[model samples]
Target: MRIGLYPGTFDPVTHGHLDIIGRATALVDRLVIGVAINRDKGPLFTLEERVEMIESEVAAIADRTGCEIVAHPFENLLIDCANDVGAKLIVRGLRAVADFEYEFQMVGMNRQLDNTIETVFLMAEAEHQAIASKLVKEIARLGGDVSKFVTPAVREALLARVGRA
Candidate 1:
């Protein structure tokens, strides 16, 4: 089967992420959502919470696209995580030029590590392009409405995390 790995911290899965996941499902038989355990970032949500949010959010997409979606938490290198999941494709969502510059370097480094795996970039739709987890969290923490950026469940989670709920 054609398996693709999409790696991200997913502190709180946003609509931008869901848009990418929905689009990615059409390209691969199985899409593994790699929830990165990057302690350096100091994510607001736990790895388990992130995985749970992704799982809850992607269920409808999986059903509609007929693609198997699974969440795999990884603390190791992204390439190693892809290898562990048998993913020949690494899917990335691009929001802007800044994202491209970073992702370009990542692809180059990943190619050096494993030439067999290819990275594919999917541009976020215009409406969702500016929706980032960091910004979303900040907005929620400041008592702003985040319903536009995240699902109701994720919005609630963010609010609860920030003690605004």
Candidate 2:
């Protein structure tokens, strides 16, 4: 069925993320949003919260594109997660050269682990190139407006998380 896996922490799903998720629908019949449970990163949102956010954000896109979107939380290796979801393609969003450099290395390592699964990179739109979840959280923590980077619902969630709401 041409399932694809797009893995991310998604502490708070940003507009940039939604852009990638929406675009990814065109390449696969089902796109599984893998919400990584990286305790080392100390994510702002819990795995359940992240999954809920992804599911809420992608609902419209799924309806519009006629693609089935589901959120799967994983604490294991990304390649293993892909296999669990029956994904032959791993979709990644690239923001800049710096992102590409890291992703390139990941692709090499992932390929060595499973040559059958291919990784596809989608460059973020120019407007979203500068939007990152880390930066967004920082901005919200410092009492800055994040309406430009996230949806209103997400902005509210961020604000509440940072005690701004």
Candidate 3:
């Protein structure tokens, strides 16, 4: 069985993320959504909350796409997480050249850690190239509706996290 790892902070899962997940699922037997716990970049939601949000979003997607979603929190290196999950591939979504630069560096680092695991980059849909969790949070915090960008669970979670409608 081919397994792929999709790692990200996922402050809140957005529709763009769902799109990537849906697309990535077609390339692998199972997709593990790894939530990286980054202390350097403070997150709007806690790890548990992020995991719950991912689970909710994944469950909804699975209902529609018939794909299996697994959520995990990783405080260690991403390569280590992939090893732990027995995944041989890391799936990433590329929004632009900027995203490629960062993801390329990560891919190299992961390759250094484990030469067997490979990173696969998928281009994000044109409409979602500019959608990011930080931007979503900023817009939602400023009273701008992000219902179109994120899933309903994420929208509610963001509203409760920021204490707004």
Candidate with maximal lDDT: 1
Name the weakest run of 10 consecutive residues (lDDT summed) in model 1: 152-161
lDDT (CA) per prediction: 0.96, 0.95, 0.89
Pairs that collide in candidate 1 are: none
Reference-based TM-score of each model: 0.99, 0.99, 0.95
**Alpha-carbon lDDT of model 3:** 0.89
21-47 in candidate 2: lDDT tens per residue? 999999999999999999999999888
Candidate 1 structure lDDT: 0.96
Residue-wise C-alpha lDDT for candidate 3, range 6-81, written one tens digit per residue: 9999998888898899898888878899999997889999999999888888886676666677999999988899
C-alpha RMSD for every candidate: 0.5, 0.5, 1.2
Candidate 1, residues 1-165, lDDT tens digits: the string is 999999999989999999999999988999999999999999999988999999999999999999999999999999999999999999999999999999999999999999999999999999999999999999999999999999999989899999999
Give me the displacement of residue 98 in model 2, in angstroms: 0.6
Summed over model 1, clashes come to 0
Model 1, residue 130: what's the lDDT? 99
Segments in model 1 whose C-alpha atoms lie over 4 Å from true places: none
Residue 106 accuracy (lDDT) in model 3 = 87
